[model samples]
Target: MTDNRVYLFDTTLRDGQQTRGVDFTPADKIAIARALDEIGIDYVEGGWPGANPTDDRFFSEPPALKRAKLVAFGMTRRPGRSAENDPGLAGVLGSKAGAACLVGKTWDFHVDVALEIDRDENVQMIRDSMKLAAKRGFEPMFDCEHFFDGYKANPDYALSCVKAAYESGARWVVLCDTNGGALPHEVSEIVAEVVKVVPGDHVGIHTHNDTENAVANTLAAVRAGARQVQGTINGLGERCGNANIVTLTAILGLKMGYETGVGDKGMKQLKKLSRMLDDRLNRAPNPHAAFVGDAAFAHKGGLHVSAVQKDPKTYEHIDPELVGNQRYILVSDQAGRSNILARFTEIGVEIDPKHPKIQRLVEDVKEKEFLGYSYDTAEASFELLARRTVENVPDYFSIERFRVMDERRFNARGQMVIESEATATVEVAGQRLHEVAVGNGPVNALDLAIRKALSTAYPSIDGVKLMDYKVRILPPPPNSDGTDAVTRVMIESAGPDGTMWRTVGVSANIIDASIMALSDSLTYCLLKSGTEAKVDA
Candidate 1:
């Protein structure tokens, strides 16, 4: 064996934090790093130590990663300072991280303009920083920023920078497409030339997605003999983003036959790991993203579904299960009986394929969707609808009525303030309960009121919390004003046991829609709790 393994280096906590509107607290970094480590990444670049309070705090109390080496990122020593005395170098070398990635200017243009220093001094900075890191017992890595552009502008000087780091005991020399404009062919050719001086095993590739070819360029570099791939989960980074490590991991294992730290078991967690990153950021996952997207293996066309029914290979590139994803037979106007049965299987429901209610459920789903209810995004709600159509579902509770009021007035300090209060009447466990609660907003007030009403009947309701809420306004029916357009609300709730579910509701009024979704959320939570109690009993 020639050892065709490519190391996975994730910089989501460092470079990804540069993305606009992205600011990772120390806790976020720790959680993300643990998830990356659990997925068998080789190196997790924590952040720039001492650069920001969050990064400083994260490095101070970093998570205990079992497999991945925590690396701190920073610039090389400055022009006037010696590596041993440089405060920046000291910050990186002093961090609890086991490795350091010191980035230095590679482009002559940047050296002449950005740093305004001599080219030789820049190369010396690279050498001195790596030597100091090695002396401090840290695995040194050199991030050659703008390496591709620098090589195009001045190949000799660019080579000198990487050679100095590698010669001074840097374990890996990463070539970065800092501007993200390098094409795949250019990446392959440049990497091929670089490997002649630096061994292929010691070279790494880092790219941004400005050209939308970061993943392709990374694969091209790998084909040209680079052994390490630096990227972020879900392509998270500044300036359009970086190559998606999730997609690269799948392609490397399944498409290219290259071994990675993430083996078969970790490979299966690709979809979950991608979604976890988005969840931490409180952003919606891109449905069309490669490999792990919701639509990656979804078959919506009637013709496609018919072929996939016979053989999944007809439409799917790879088994969705291989990446912790499942095939989706989207029920729509074009859906057939095959689609409904496949969906039943996907949702873990067992019913006769010829059951008459199958058609009824399909009809109901289409009807509700036409009214602006999206089952694809609200699988919990869809599951309830499915069960209700085929079998009876336990009505844990029913809301008699609910009302919310918002009041704005001047407080004791003469400062204006706004408060919302909600009152709800519900029947649960054969008792009608009425409760009132105040919250920061109307939705929160309603949620609190409902929970208070159910306190005596269901104590477990206290453990369930709302994770996220999304609202979208759909086009109103003809003759209706924009303010009266149909509103859709989706509520994501998490149970005490770490299980999460999504429910949805749609109505002309946003408040009514929110209450509908909230009701579904509570119902789903109770249903899960009751099932678990049964299992425990």
Candidate 2:
């Protein structure tokens, strides 16, 4: 590898799994491993095999990766045990991974206090374990846990620990900011000193994010001569988190002029990969995340929007598309004509900036926003509003009436069960259709009834599925009843081809709001599928 080339080691399956409430099933680990391989990661740390049954099964039939080297992670051989006899070391060897990473105590405090072992014995452990792994035909790497803090306290001992691993035939000696409290300058200083004893090509950096400086520290280490960086996707890890490899990769490739496994093409998939992880975890992506967030490239202020529209470089440091994100011109009270024109174009509507209707639309949007509509987060709803003004939206269906009932009753087993039932009367294609359904909740029942009523007239409705539903209660008006607050519902729907979209609705009643959003979601799906065009014709 060239001096400018940096290796990306992803530990999302191992360290990221250490996060609170995060437990990846064997299937989830397989999926994430494939995704990491697809993105050209250098090394993917599969978890400790013998420590957990799930990880053991995962390694038993590891996913066939084309690019990334599957690595098994474990601690050094136990004190007073031979590397060959230690079960932990045996587990790492039996994992059948292409590589093995063994973490050992580099900090004297951990050596004396945590492990209660003599300093020389810890060095022997690192040497023995790494030598054993290499002899077994696996590329071995050593994680010098708490190297920075240890170096600060006992520089000679920390350097000896790293030296021991390198001399033991380890391919990489990674310095770790295990406590995650080191400043960038401190990292640079320590790494520079270590490279004097060990070549930079043989060194790597692993950092945590307790002080929110993991990325900075990792970069600092690189500048000081480390060639590899270890981190997790979206910064998911134990405590505060690990360095976010997504952000680190972008900065390394785009800004710092370093070559990573994820080249320009792979960089475009970063956002998609980040979102895929969040999807598997059933969590929403952070809108403000560095490179791939929803709001990363969004411009809202009038001056900022105008500047970005004229020349994106005026406001944005880089093209959003370079990272699989797009620039968004948000419409709000702060929006100007530039914002309106840019937003219209983004939603595939071609309206002249000078058109009289553009001003009308701007004013209308502002008034509706004052009435509790947020166009920034609900682009699907904004598109519907814009399309309605420019052309007639196909009137696919209309609800004449709907009724929902909820009841709690004890069953023969003496268990109390709550049931909800909904009935819907819908007018579709000049025909009245009635349908009823029962569900676990009122929203689910209403959604089922509506879909049942319309599926016959529009068979394509059967392909649409509601993926997510979120409701927020807005503050009540000053003179209104505080107990009855307006609700804003955002529904995420997906078509059979996996095309997803979000629609929003607001009303005093939660059910009414949910229904409105659900209808809009289905309407948008039909329109996008061109079914609405066929219906109109």
Best by TM-score: 2
Once fitted onto the true fold, the runs of candidate 2 whose alpha carbons sit more than 4 angstroms away are: 478-484, 532-537
Clashing pairs in 2: none
Give the lDDT of residue 298 in candidate 2.
92
TM-score of each: 0.88, 0.95
> Which parts of model 1 are misplaced by more than 4 Å?
1-3, 53-64, 94-96, 346-349, 427-435, 451-455, 458-460, 478-484, 530-537
**lDDT tens digits by residue: candidate 2, 1-537:** 789989999999999999999999999999999998998899999899898998999999999999999999998999999999998889889887999999999999989999998889999999999999999999999999999999999999999999999999999999999999999999999999999999998999999999999999999999999999999999999999999999999999999999899977889999999999998998889999998999999999989988887899998999999999988888777777888888778778876667888888888888877766787877788888888877678888887888899999999999999999999988787778899999999989999999987786678889888888888889987888898678889888888998778888889889988888988887887777777533321
Give lDDT: candidate 2, residue 222: 99
List CA RMSD, all candidates: 3.7, 2.0
lDDT of each: 0.90, 0.91
lDDT of 2 at 491: 88
lDDT of 1 by residue, 273-342 (tens): 9999898998989999888998999887768888999999999989999999888787765667787777
